[model samples]
Target chain A: MAMIVDALSWVFLLTGGFLGVSGGIGILRFPDFFTRLHAAGVTDTLCAALILLGLMMQAGWGLVAVKLAFIILFLSFTGPVAAHALARAALHGGLMPLLHRAEDDPSKS
Target chain B: MRHIISLTLILAGFWLLLSGHFVPLLLGLGAVSILLVVAIALRMDAFDHENQPLHLTFRFTPYWVWLAGEIVKSNIEVVRCIWGPVSAISPTRIHLTATQRSDVGKVIYANSITLTPGTVAMRLEGDQIEVHALTRAAAASLQGGEMGRRVRELER
Candidate 1:
């Protein structure tokens, strides 16, 4: 059981690290707020949630577990709202999304 | 009333779990958690209906399980898009007029929209959601309307 637990923790840690990296890279490399929003969403839900679940297992029945669960609950509820608000704010601030050239052709527009 | 009790118990139990002992710590946590439960119950304009069939839990579990699979699938899709010569991710804006009634139901709908790959809920203007989708497929999925229906059912 302990070995299995250890392995699971490592797996979660690795996934979290990957997500952290992906989200970070997306935030940096993505061209627009919308694209970056995709990155940020994945990081929060997939990466962060997985990592925290792994950490919760390691914490056992202690307060760390309790605290971690609270954080996860709060994050689950708030993360999407935050992203929605950011995207709206960005749009309101004049961040026009880039369109595909063919789609952007004057005939289409 | 019911929610307050459940909240108090959960908070106190969690507090004790974190504190990892009994006596003064446990009792003190019990007092604090009870206070907090009362406070939160007041804040939400909440009522005694904590007994509502945790339908969202049961409903969204499978939806989320499937969603996780969908995320992995979409992640692969996005990676493919990013790696291509043109990085041909077509950024498109879409308007979705929602059918969900309650605020919680609307939220579940919006979050589910955000949860799926390649889409973001830009804003909720009344009953309509302004979405920025990364591709035509993503935009189409939002318009398909299955998720909204499912969330509406869950809310009931």
Candidate 2:
């Protein structure tokens, strides 16, 4: 049982580390600010979640695990709110996303 | 009245769990601090249906689990796009209909959209939300309405 838990923890940790690096690469590679937000969202959401879940497994069933759960809860709430506000502000400031088709305008009636 | 009690209990539990000091002085200090915070909340009129949201508790857990699955799935897709050619990303802007009836439900839907890695809810106006998706297919998946349907179910 201990071996299984250790293996799972490592799996989650490694996958999270890989995703975090990819998200960083994505931010650099993406064309515009809006698309880059999607990359950063990857790091904040699933990457953060997996890393924390791995830590929780290491912590076992205790108050430390509970605190980790709270961190995940707060991140899930704040991550999107921060992303939404940034995206909203970017749009309001006239930063247009580079679309597959330029004619497909979101602001047009 | 109910919200105030719920808030107080939650605050007390949080303080106890965080502090971990079982001494009498700490307990008294915690109680006093909780009372002061609750009093401030009352003065600010923060105890309301929207703030407490006790009605959605039972239903929300399942929705959250489903959303976690969605996040993982999209994280994989976005990661693949990241590692692939830049042209692999479509970066499309689309509008989705917020099928929820209440403000809280709509906010949840929009936030859920934004929470997923490949999509961001850029603008929310009445029943519509403007979304910027990493790919056109991502936008199409959202239009399928499974998530929006789940959010709608939360309100009931």
Candidate 3:
């Protein structure tokens, strides 16, 4: 049972790490600011949740698990609010998004 | 009255969970601090139902589970959009009318929009929210009103 639990925890940790890395790459590669926010905000919450869940499993039934749960809850609640505020600020600052229009050719227009 | 009781309980529970020390002196200190915090909150007139929201505890769990699923699905879509051709993303501004009745519900709806990948609620005025979506598909999904409906359900 202990071996199985350890293996499961490893799987979760590795997957969470992979997601986090991909999100970082997405933030760098995305074209504009808003899309980059999408990359950062979405995966940040889920990746943290997954990693903390793995840690909670490893912690077993204890205060550590409770603390991990609290952290996850806090992140989920705050992440969106922060994203909203950032987007609002950017919009107020007149950061227009680069819209992909159909009539505009990629090379010429 | 109920709000005050719930807030005090929540604060005390948080203190116990965070401290993890059962010594009499530490516990006594925790109690005093919690009381002080509650007193300040009450004096500020921030102990209303909207602020505390103890009633939504039971309704929020299922909404959270569904939201987690939505987040995972949208995250995959966003990852693909990032790796795929840049032209695939069509950034668009959308105006959505929030169907929620209360300010709390409207805030939840807007936050949920911002929480999901590819969509951000940029401005909220009255019952209308201005949003920016990374792609047309995401904007269409927001127009579908599933999340708004879920938030309305949560309000009840």
- Per-candidate interface DockQ score: 0.43, 0.84, 0.48
Runs of candidate 1 with Cα error greater than 4 angstroms are A60-63, A101-109, B1-18, B40-60, B82-86
lDDT of 2 by residue, B92-121 (tens): 888889989998899999999999999999
**How many clashing residue pairs, candidate 1?**
1
Docking class of 2: high
lDDT of 3 at B125: 84
Higher lDDT: candidate 1 or 2? 2
Off by over 4 Å in 2: A106-109, B46-51
lDDT string for model 1 (A1-109, tens) is: 9889879988988878876676777767778778878777777776777789899888887678778887887887788788888888887887777654445322111
TM-score of chain B only, all predictions? 0.76, 0.90, 0.94
| Residue A89 in candidate 3, Cα distance off native in Å | 0.7
- RMSD, each candidate, Å? 4.3, 1.9, 4.0
Native-referenced TM-scores of chain A, all candidate models = 0.84, 0.95, 0.87
Residue A5 displacement (Å), model 1: 4.0
- Please give each candidate's TM-score: 0.78, 0.94, 0.91
Report candidate 3's fraction of native contacts.
0.66
Model 2 alpha-carbon miss at residue A46, Å? 0.7
Output the better candidate (1/2) by DockQ.
2
